[model samples]
Target: MDRIDGGGTMSLHFGVFEVYGPQVGGTLSWPHPLSDSIDFADSQHWVDIAQIMDRTGYDFLFFADGFGYPILGDDIALGAVERGINFSGYDPAGLVPILMRETTGLGFVITANTGVDHPVQLARRFSTLDAISNGRFGWNVVTGSSQNAVAELFGHTEMVPHDVRYAIAAEYVELAKKYWEESWSDDALVADPVRGIYADRTGITRVTYDGEHYRSDGYFGAPPTRQRTPVIFQAGTSPAGRAFAATHAECVFVQATVPAHTARNVAHIREVAAEQGREDPRIMSGLTVVVAETSQEAHRLAAEFDAMQTDDVVATLYAGNTGIDLLALDPERTLHQVLEAGGPVGQMGTSNIERFLGSNGAPAPTVREIIDDLKGKGTRGFRIVGDPHKVADGIEALAAETGLDGFLIEPVFGTRDIAAFGELVLPILRERGRLADRVDGETLRERMRR
Candidate 1:
């Protein structure tokens, strides 16, 4: 927690932000020689990445996932499929145990939707993962995206309002806590073979809940793991989302492109956390670094990656995240005008728009301008294109300015960017004591706190 001016080594935690699908971001460089065409269906791809991250001093791997894809009118968007724009992927939670088995000292956080998954089901699932990982597991709790599409896929007639979904998530998490923390006492599992008793039945309690959005009446199926509840990770920046994260999240994720905006977000979340009688949660922002041996080489590589980005891919991803269907909107209309018209905004829509405005620097921009700007950023967040030294300086300066505890290293072109950071920048960070010393038997929560 020491700062540069404080005359102590700064220790910043780092994690890799990844998607299980082929298109990790908006970039369409899968066909390019530099890009990695990972087989989404293969577990080996994840295993390979996990080992690399584990060896490269990464604290964890965070996966962003959902069940629904972008849509055009009433059908799935063709661009989403053809362009491979964050379209398809398998559930990443299933990869946690696999990755844990494949690596040492590395943690895993997978996305789970509170809207669609039952509290009991989610609680038990995470409990199983927690046991498997020996406490190296975390949960990225989400309300889900593509509101209408997800609702239809889940067989719901109507979509839950943005704020209402958070209200429900609050209750959902409350009930899940009962299953995770209250169902079994700390000494409930007593495997005494000589006494012919596997557990202390009296210590186990049945959980009963009847909330507005969920109801449960049963004993938890899983027992306490190393950490009874997995570390809670949330990325909701809307008013309700921020409140939810302030109350429950142990680590909060943000995507404000500018350092000043990111600083404000961290301060606001800490203020809310203080108001809620909780300690400051660890806040990490999205970051994609394109680095090489020299500054010129890095910029050239970044330009090459940028050239692969297309308007259709950007718009498709924007529509998928915000549910606005940018391709259908008036190209001449400003973002403010589009918001004023009022269309479907998905769970992530509000935060995404806020980041767009912050990055664009006020003065609402036209749809065409938004698309053009998004082609470079596209919700992937702050990017640094330079050599090892510049990348290190930017990271240290950002951490000092924003008071962020961590950075989620998103990929610019598959894991190539990650490898570059590990090889070039990580050494500088380590030399400067910007990263925590690795410890054996450290849980995900413990590692992240460092």
Candidate 2:
């Protein structure tokens, strides 16, 4: 295939609430005094949401999972639960089959970290899900971020450095691909009635990989799914992460806070992929949408969301993800102080910090600045609050300017927000020829290719 011209337009592939689960609502946590009022423990509601996403022409629903909770400010996670903030939930993968069963045609993407699961076990589990979902499965490869997660589950004191983790991930993926793509030939499965032969023995081969981080022996157990290897999705923007995605990822998730930054990252990935002899990978950025009948209503909704956000909860969540103890800093102190202090707790790396801070400005925004921005306006990745046409226009403008593949649509209110996007913004996108008509029976790869 020829390179995608910088000028050529492409149809956007939409993803629903699949990326972040109900946990997002907890970002501000439940505003209601009663925790019972908002219940995410129930899986049935998510199943119903899955059906809705599939019916609405969403290409896929990607699930983002983390192994540990935010452990900041002496067990502030408790506050997360009390505030009904995004604290408690089952594993995102556990919810995948439930959602898959409710929708046919909607792709299912699950996050599995190399730091947590063994290579053979992880590969087998993904293979099983691929079989169960009839090949509509993708893995968002993640090397976990939380130290609590690593220490609690794996008995490690903390996660390895970012570069080392990616090194491990690179080997893990290479071994997995060998098992998924190279182990079994396209003609591996041949059921012969006369001979009662299920699979041609000659067609299957063993995978023997001895790498620095992982090793696996024997052929892949399950037969190849529709897409032999599930679509590879990755979310790393660091140099090492970009290198890994360039070689293996079919889809790349970016967390830039601005359109220009997102565009730069997308271009970098494409350039790296070209150097790696791979076609351009689809790039999706994390986006939060606030939509209403009018722009004014949208602003009101955003304000309501901000009103719901508590600084304590935001600080806790931030510290949890960044390994920074925000409580140590005076709330009044600017972010520049923290940068100057250069404490190990919050200073993970430049790229990691930038994910929270928009790249357009200097020493990165302070916690106060970030919170204020979220309150007044939204950050990065497309924040448009308007009627259907207005939202569509924002999406188009972002696409045209940044050259993004699509968005991982985050809903303000669990499933309802995504449902609204499908009902309202989708039609306008279709009319503008930015989205493709529903294509029946297409594999995830096929749909994404379109």
Candidate 3:
């Protein structure tokens, strides 16, 4: 059971889907008068945002990794730049420490593309954050999806096979786990001033692991963190991705536009975990809430958000994510047919079309269909635009339908949007005994698992 709050019980948790660099996609294609006021580039802005989440009693804050700007027909896609798609931003590794210092109870989850990052270096960086957060750190483990990221990071032009990439990721995680868990004993650190000792030297020992993709020999340079190994989080829902999550991840990101279908996915993963003799991982879906006192006003806000996603912004973002540039493809080729056969598959084949097929369990969507879907979109996920009651109903419905543990809110207006949810929907959830209203002293892992 989760920790009970002052007058309510914790039935669900909430986190932000993304709190990325200042350059994150926004009111680029259209007039985003309010968003212009937000300075994503300023480190203080994030600190302020972290404080907001902390005050709101949010479970965690997460940031995404970007290789570079989006690429379409040109080496550097100018259209994307004008549309304000992908661009360079602050490093999460760097940002997490800053946020850790600024806020408490708000866990920080940052991405580490296991396909490209060295296990030892990853362990050190994550361990440092975990220590700083006092074990309030979690990792969003990803196999690189962007081809640009792959080429620049690994010096590889052609992509690796999808399953093989996961296999590599599998080992990458294993080796990192070795370092975080086996390197230092709980009593290794002996900061005894009178004894003239800072550590029990004998308690520290080297941990060696040799896998198909990585090998390491040495004790983890960092001390044992709050969570011995930070809680593992994964995002891919492909077969290989699902398998890996079942075996290792404590939490997963599911693309669940269809709640009934997502229920099946959740059940399947839990079954897999049971088979592995591990507890089920918490399942969190992305949520967007546009709430106002009046339903009409909420709808207006939704429309305003919808206007900003231009054609270039939509295509570039989709292409960057799935490695399938619908604009670059032969218009005559049916996207569904090609995707089924691994059409122009990248390293991990984590394309939108593949995810669409798996989540929908319907015919592969056509190229025209995908374009139609992306036109003038503000954001993705299951968005609820209505008065406070309706918004709360939608959240409860989705959780009941899919057995979801929580949602990661992705807002267009950043902190203001999150504030609206905290103000409008949170009270209702609290009234219904579904929200955690405070963070006392539970570890991040404890909070998520409960």
Candidate 4:
């Protein structure tokens, strides 16, 4: 609560990864001891939580998205239905206006797949939000991981190749950027009642973009906002995805592997940005923590929650992703060969490949390894379990170890999870000078960009 002015060893950014609607993933279908009793179905629930986060000095509240439920075994929706998996709640963009109206400081970052959106519409939507929110909006660009969702949900019978999807994302983002950055001159809007004209029509210009994936030319329809382009956030870990982020992203979300792995990722991203004549993007790692009054209590809480990874859960989610049933793979074959024999290279999933799921250069994992990884929060990101002090120590050490920008907490409960963290660990962080000084009127972009 006290000011640190121009001093602090380092100021780590903070954010929470939670749903705008009902919950999904490991956050749902599990017992929540610290969960808030707020009604998730009601709009007020989101607004109140947003306000709480803003008051606590969070940088942003991020919502990840997917079009469909995770597929387990044969039935695509059964496992999700039985496990109470809610893929999406409210539309993040639509709900942004509501949250913005209620809270003054928190930034909102929403994920949108490049494979599905029209460049122009996506551009206008974000540009409009930025202007209206006073530059408090951000866009998290993703080349969707699920082939089935893209095909079935979006009505595309043929799934786009993973690498090719990145190519398309490149064009999609380029076109969107042109609209956000170049389509209209800053002085284009002139409201002059004295001349009896809201003129400056001469300054307005059109954007024309043509690429292998898309073509568009039009006068931009969105008015300029605080940040002409809302802060560009990207969360791709693949080589192509990393290259794309280096070229365009302002905030890069990376899965937390080991400290060395994350440190390497941060260095590579900065190097890529430098090559593109840009500074290093603020790099954030996903973190899921289980903490209570004591280290023993925290571990007990974590152990109490069942993983709920039945065969049905694994098969449904895996099949929906790569369209290859793990149960069907030959037991004697190595995973590398099994995948090759399963189907085309492009169709084999790129998201859960060896680098992300298993350790580096380690031979492909056995089917047992696959199940273990998918069960609960396996190899997902940075995970810590302990009391407030221990949790704070882990976070501080990791940030110091990896030179990370900050972390997006994968909320373990409802709003209470975040509230508890703010009350518990935030003071320790403040005392240690890890969090940035709270600026009264800092714009979201200014807060993160610095």
Candidate 5:
């Protein structure tokens, strides 16, 4: 394959568990027993998975989170729950500590929104976790996109406007940085044995900052962790989102209906990041992988998986995400007007909605077209089905064309999908010299830089 760097050499960074926890069960909605049966409740299982991923040289296992169920017709979130969707799983954060203890070098990236917790609390929690994990921690910063969550849990009457939420997130991350980076100096942790002191108090500095959304007036309580501040990950494609990510994110997750669209967004983020003083921000796109011994078998498996995704589940998910109930709109009605009108809720403002609805004045895609697009045949980040070599080729192609740093491999099944990737695709990447060799207990930052 041709390389973007023109050196006939390339590196492929792979991450897993972007939505629900891979495509093992053939849906992203509720009643996700397929994923649950993999033993999220078992601490040993989490550790084994972490160890396996690290040994295979997988970059990280990212947990995609949501605060509340979808806001469709019923309060039940039936479409998601009944179908074993993405929302059926438990919060991955609760499992991170165990996983951290299980593996030596694997990075743990968790999604925590600025809307849910205060900066002081967030700073303390991440700092403690970083220390516990010995610097193998990253945060996927988000200003929540669930209107139902804001109203029900946070006591907000409505979700904040898109731009305004980004504004808040900017300040939120700034506060976290101040706590993580500015509060403690390298000399702070003396750990002098004869002196019977663990830390030199004088080396710790207090940070005082006044901002529109948040303010702080204290030194970080915990001592410095491996990386003072965990690496920041952001996922949003709005103009404001891009600007915010450009200023703060080290890694950005992107999703688009097609490869061209993914490439366009990658370019946009790079430009914005450069403008904000970051020369490059690692871009990771969402992808699904299905692999078998032969190309034909892969196709047959993919077809069976596609057949399992009922229209009700897909439509319900689409409606909840866009805030325009597809059930209310005529199935045959063009989504043009809805796109023009936007959503009733502020948090539902996503750039992908237009692409899904064909609001950019392109030919509107049918529900099947949308689903097929999600399957990744014509789409950018989604990887529908392929044998080991085919899957590797698709990943390499995407990175070369879009200048992306890597991909977040959303699984098609439970642990088996991830296990299959480790067994099949990883070896191909390794033979091609596109994958990293096992490192000896490196920090997350060092690993990322490598």
Candidate 6:
């Protein structure tokens, strides 16, 4: 099958996978002197980044968010706050309209939990956002990973099982889709001042759902936006997650450590999507790029960034991600030994461990080594440390090797690295025919599909 476009060029889409928090992806990035993390709380900070990407030819700026903080308890939570380790940020949903107004062509993807939000409210909110962005909007659907924290916040006593959360999300999305795609016909809205009728009421229908996990019955308030259902994105790599993405997500994010592994995942999702009658699920792997005018300088910058990852910060963020306490465990013990001894782990933690094992070819890594990997290139996709040419070459090679649709660039020093990438690598890619020309006023869905 031909992967290239009709022009026979490698037109790869690019987006930044962001968190609205102190750090984007790398933990404890706020304290770095070169980082623009100081203004994370300011709306202008986000606006600046969006404008930069918009001018640089990025397809979208994705905001990965959640309502629950990873840490619990006062003392540990205080420590997390003092270190600024993914502990602070505004809701990306609220920031969408503000950003869309500021940028011309850059798309905005906001992460929203299907398990927690009511289907009706979620549908309406996305519809409004899509309209406000003039179709430059997407939703990153997640099934509430921070189960304990999320459950506590929502006043639920029992934690929803991992697979069960996927089930709930499936139903939740189905109901929301009905609201987005079925509630209103193409000609529902009509500004007929002559007949004193604003909308053809006969063309509108009530949307209702009574599933095992959710219930919603309502006349959808918002009319259909440019893209009636905003582009759906999912970022889970587990079996249940892959199934969910295959079934619904228009774009998928994977954080494999190697190209071969990423290729396997991409192929699997495409196959599943094909079986489900949804062809060509767009898959993007997480990538962290560090580039400078010289290879030596880029390596020096990468090393400096690595040096800032303190043990406490690494452990704090790692524990938050996998539910495994690196500090409490014996550093010398192999990961194999820890898991074999029945280590305490949740669904996310187990998945991370398994990915680590698969990448290393064995679980012989010490707990400390594993911790270091997590702080470095563990889950973050193929790291490129070089000049602009080297970065572009690596990206092109990886795309050819893995059959990935695109990449979600992970920031090393927040906006500093993102800006650096824009200034250095983007031009090289544009010249190499790896990026498509930006079409102004195109909807997010159109840009993604193109």
Model 2 ranges with Cα > 4 A deviation: 1-8, 18-22, 29-37, 73-76, 84-86, 331-342, 345-352, 355-367, 374-380
After superposition on all C-alphas, the RMSD of every candidate to the true structure, in Å, is 2.2, 3.3, 2.9, 3.3, 3.5, 2.2
- Candidate 6 wrong stretches, greater than 4 Å: 1-3, 72-79, 336-346, 357-361, 377-379
**Lowest lDDT 10-residue stretch of candidate 3:** 22-31
Find the 10 residues in a row with the least total lDDT in model 1.
Answer: 1-10
Error of 4 at 368 (Å): 0.8
lDDT at position 354, candidate 1: 60
lDDT of 5: 0.70
Model 2 per-residue lDDT tens digits across residues 69-182? 666644646554565344555677677877777788889888888756667777778887877787788898987655554465667765577778888888888888887788
Clashing pairs in 4: 71-316, 71-317, 72-316, 73-315, 73-316, 131-225
- Residue 42 accuracy (lDDT) in model 2: 75
Provide TM-scores for the models. 0.95, 0.89, 0.91, 0.90, 0.90, 0.94
RMSD of 3: 2.9
- TM-score (C-alpha) between model 5 and the true structure: 0.90
Candidate 4 residue-wise lDDT, 26-51, digit = tens: 33433455555225667787887798
Model 6 TM-score relative to the real fold: 0.94
Clashes per candidate, residues 3 or more apart or on different chains: 0, 10, 1, 6, 20, 0
lDDT, candidate 5, 11-92, per-residue tens: 6577776432323323542224434334555666566667778877788888777665555763645665665443556677
Between candidates 2 and 4, the one scoring higher on TM-score is 4
Question: What's the CA error at residue 284 for candidate 4, in Å?
Answer: 1.0
Tell me the lDDT of model 5 at 241.
Answer: 76
lDDT of 3 at 446: 85
Better of 3 and 5 by TM-score: 3
